[model samples]
Target: MTARHAGYIVTLAEDIREDDADHIMTALRMVSGVISVQPVTANLDMAIARQQVHGEVRGKVLQLLKELQ
Candidate 1:
């Protein structure tokens, strides 16, 4: 049977430096079977960020369609 695990929150031995977090997350995402990695923090609103990105992409596609018409 496949594991029903959703995800995990990895904590570093010491607080990750702002400059190093990107490198660390990138390395974790390179591991086999890893889907995605994001930094967890109180101030970061991932949902809103994802929605904004989706909206931007959608707008761009609509603009391209209009240009093609």
Candidate 2:
């Protein structure tokens, strides 16, 4: 099947620890549409969504990270 792609620039919550970020990355990778997750900084993450899924994936990832705040 052909898949759409979306780029995400996520900002991590200030209180989230390195371990938690690792966990979050793991979880994000498990999501259906996620292609890759990269940690840009303690406070920033970048992800690629392989299946855009009507544009919900990007917003979902953003919300998930923001929820950590």
lDDT tens per residue, model 2, 1-69: 998658677765444666767788898899887898987643223233323453687799889999998
Candidate 1 overall lDDT versus native = 0.79
Per-model clash counts, in order, read 0, 0
RMSD of each: 12.9, 13.6
Work out the TM-score per prediction: 0.46, 0.42
Top-scoring candidate (lDDT): 1
lDDT of 1 by residue, 17-58 (tens): 677688788899998889988776634485577679899999
Error of 1 at 44 (Å): 14
Question: TM-score for model 2?
Answer: 0.42
